[model samples]
Target: MRTLDHAACARAIFESIGGGENLVSAAHCATRLRLVVADAPKVDQKRLESLPGVMGVFCAGGQLQIILGTGTVNRVYEEFIKLSGLPGAPAAQKCTAPVLPLPQRLVKTLGDVFVPILPAIVAAGLLTGILDALGRALPAVAAADWFSFLKMVSGTAFVSLPVLVALSSARVFGGNLFLGGVVGLCMVHPTLLNAWSVGTAENVPVWHLLCFNVKQVGYQGHVIPVIIAVWLMSRLERWFRSRVPAALDLFVTPLCTVLITTFVTFTILGPCFSFAENCMIGLARQLSTVGHGIGALVMGALYPVTVVCGLHHMYNVIEAGLLSAGSLNIWMPIASAANFAQCGACLAVAFKTRDPKNKTVAIPSALSAALGITEPAIFGVNLRYVRPFVCAMVGGAVGAWFGTVTGIGATAYGVTGLPGFLIVGGYILPYAELLALSGGVAFAATWLFWQDVPAQDKTPG
Candidate 1:
């Protein structure tokens, strides 16, 4: 026996999973070592679970995840990558399974695309919130000449969002990064009026295409069109690479691919997709107005499904638009409810579990969930038992209804659970009430209905 040394165990895991050659990418979230591998079936699940340090193993979101507590997973991950000899873990993380339905695959694709950029967006959102709160409290600063400079810190990321999305999307879609960047920049070109400013004018400048005229608006914070354009560009670039002669391929492929893609973007992709995007935004707004908080109830119940299905990143579009327009993100409260519900459920499991190892894992995971990181609780504790996860969702739905009826929202983009109080700020009272409604109900229900599964490792040696 290896006696569970982290490095030696990591090496065993690497080898058992068909070695570094089989690995397409490596990443971790909270408490799990997440891998997107070439052959998931080749990995020995029983052998992995039997490993001394590993707490659990499962596949979700097209990822092979090994749960090793948060602090422990980081150390093991560092060792695993060092042994694999990969360059600083795979930066291009796109999780997909041929076996999955198209909708699920799309969800994973969208999540992977935004994961790299979400942190910056979240930071910008927090900065914006802080400024908003400060400006209200201190009128002097709001009137200062340099207030715009302060706004820029938070405003720049959201305004130039397409560029950030472009950089990531090109890599994920296998297109030329430089060309993709150029396309994104073109969408937000200084010459074109900002997307938000379009409404202020009776009629903005128009571009005449073959059939119709476009509003000559910048994409600014839009999501879907930039993605569609990049996907088309990547496909075109690949097609050109195959046909063009090697001598001509270098220059011809780059120039011809980008030129064709750019032309199609202005004439077709941008305008059509922008309309579709606006319709979706309009639908979300309408849902907010739906009677008796029904939309909130449905969204709260389904929000956890997004996390499970890996579609949660799709909300980045809606949330960004809301914050940019000065309305706080309505989704944030639902997110808080869903996230804290998981924490409540996890804590319930911790209190009920008799096994020392299960107890050890559940306690910290609950803490992580309350702090606005829920995967540790979701994967390691609540979902493992099944019943608690359901209880959490029901609780979340109830909390969400309250939040919606009260019109509670958060100033920031990403923070959730207890820590969301920072962004909830003025909305804290109602937000905290929602958390209590969600978490208290979830914890009590889970505690009453759930029981711990006996751990084999807990048996006496």
Candidate 2:
């Protein structure tokens, strides 16, 4: 293999997208160079794909993603930023790509808000799982001082999750992160009843000011309400900044923003949105159990479709709600089933395809999918072939039904596929069974139904 020319690759990408003037922002995540261009039509995508080190190119979530693989993409991103003269990690800006539908935009926003905080959640989740497993395997260890220390460290992220969400949402919505954090802290303050314990607390405290009664409740393990509150805060801060005098703006804007936002949030936004969020979570739990797991089955099958449309991140809100309410994240199992099923379908394609390129791409993409990143398999092999995608969907549906019926759940969120075993706690056997069932179904279906298409007959769109 030839050494990848990072600078040359960056230059090629910059030039192909019509140089710095056409680019609005440039960023990279694990594998792809995510770019927001001034005009979508001006992007010479073919030239980009043909560039050395460029593996694939596509548009999703209102941005053009150049699949440059791991390590390589970040290096190229650094060089690309230099050449384009763009700042690293700027505030979220509007993508000028062909206008996406409202749902797509909203999904993109949620993804932006949540993606930054996933590492924290994943770290905490994995640690929480490990601690739970240790406690179960060695009950006495749960009483150990070191074990207690580890537990506290692991619990901080989940307990302060609203703060994390608020900070990220503020950035995405273009607000001060610190102020946003303050809003988050206010919602989860010690004066209120912990949202998780609201059901069991015998005497729920209420605050009576002038005319109305407000429940002193903390918003823990919640996503939507925190997001709404921060978004309101961001808008208000910006509004106040424009009107407030520069001499007083520094103190006045933040004070007013926090005071007004928290006051309304506590009085109205918290109650109404938290209720709505709860209803949504309740509906999700009901669906997971309804009609003997029919809802889980359908959701599992359709989950990948939402992923393809960039709407799957919305599930993060639901999962966060479930976890916050002291319920297990049952949604993770369904997601894992769906993701692993795709891996199975892709692997089948790898073994069956005679085309050298198809075989090469399918094998690694399948492995990536198995490890919990399915974009490579879904876009590069399964969806491209069409048949395998459907097969995987069928597999996902069956596996999700089994997982739901068996009551498989994870201790946390943001993990799936094989690594899901870590966070599954006592559900290890059932989770493994779910993966096997889903993967087996998908593999068998794809092997029996899908035929290799000639390279010239198909191309990624």
Candidate 3:
């Protein structure tokens, strides 16, 4: 069968889905294209799935995802973003939809909170890794004054994590910044810590001062509990205002929510957060027992299909699980390499294609994929080229095997793209050399495997 015109195929997709006007909002998660439409009745899912550059179409989390190859997805996403004006300018918008549902909304909110601060997190992780490396390479550096300064710089983010989470959550929840900051301060308040520490001491306090154990530690950089606290606070504040006379409403609401929510945060929410953290950590430990080979194979094989379902973010919980445990695990490294492999496959197609537009889409996808961003690569390249995607998966399996055998694991929690190295530094020893070798091998395998595929057999959208 003759291949479809790539750009025309995208336009047809837009038109068939009731055009850009039907779009209420759009976003992309780790893999799938998420879109919310004004009228689902007009969407032709079967037709969209058949379109050139489309891999599949389905609904999840109340959004429609048009799965494209890693090669062309980004271009199509960009085109769609321009057609629908989102937060970033037409040219700059990367994701396609907005947050939906309670859990998804919370995830989106946390993502927004963390994304802006990711650079700082990465820098801190890198510095910490470098310090660890320096300690290993030049033991004397640890004794030097500069090393202390480096430690301070790297540790500041984590130590004051609640402050950051509060600031970001305030913006997301549209609450009082000062109150949120105050709440954040309470989480890390020295008095609270001391009281908790002393209470939990082996010599228990003569009388349990409070019904709840004060010794539980607060998660400094966490979002879930704090956001939930603030959301409940907002509701309480509103309720308080309704009951109080108009003259005292403003003062009463703030005072009430702050006091009530603060108590809840410390006594209930704080413990809940710690429990969730432990649960995630426990899950990671369970996954670790499976051995890296089986773990990577299962994760890598399901990676593409997960992308199709927009459930890839669910895998990120595994990374977070590893982070809470203060160790590295098997998921991110393998998944990241697989994504880059998709990029390499896309690049091959871009080079082989005679069409200027397809070439245009493929090149950027190649770059984005290499840098650790794969939306562009997947949507732009691999999804369009079926054989290339399959080859990319093969490459992913190979990379996963390498990671499993070598015990490659991410050291930190960050996006898995090229920047993943800094994250790798968080848990693994000899991070720098290991990262270079692992990343290089994955890239090489992807290029070598997909570069020879015949362009004529590439799949139509």
Best by the lDDT measure: 2
TM-score of 3: 0.70
Considering TM-score, where higher is better, how would the candidates rank from best to worst? 2, 1, 3
**Per-residue lDDT of model 1, residues 1-461, tens digit only:** 22347898789889878897788778876578888778878898888866766767889756788887757788888898899776534442533356567887776667667778878877887777777777878878987768778788887887788888888889888888999999889899999888878778787898787787777888875788888989999999999999999999989998998888888988889989988887877787667657788888888777777787667877777776676555678878888888888888888888988877677778878888887777778777777788888888988888888888988877767788776776765676898899999998899999988866567643211
Query: Over all chains combined, what TM-score does candidate 1 have?
Result: 0.87
Candidate 3 deviant stretches above 4 angstroms: 1-110, 193-213, 220-223, 241-246, 314-331, 352-354, 415-417, 422-461
* Cα displacement (Å) at residue 273, model 3: 3.9
Rank the models by lDDT, top first: 2, 1, 3
**Residue 60 displacement in candidate 1 (angstroms):** 3.1
lDDT of 3 by residue, 1-461 (tens): 35545567657777878886777666554445567777889898767755665644656556666656444556666666666565422211223324345665545555655655556655766677677777877889899999999899986765665666666667656677777887877777764433225445665323133786555354543445666676666677667876899998777778888999888887787668767866765665455336656666555545765664445554544554454334554576667667766766776767766765567667766776766666656654666555666666666665665566666666455656566665554345433333344345444544565443344454443
Q: Which candidate has the highest TM-score of all? A: 2
- After TM-score superposition, the amount by which residue 164's alpha carbon in candidate 2 deviates from its true location, in angstroms, is 1.4
Q: Any runs in candidate 1 off by more than 4 Å, and if so which?
A: 1-9, 12-31, 35-55, 61-63, 69-72, 84-97, 145-147, 249-251, 324-326, 453-461
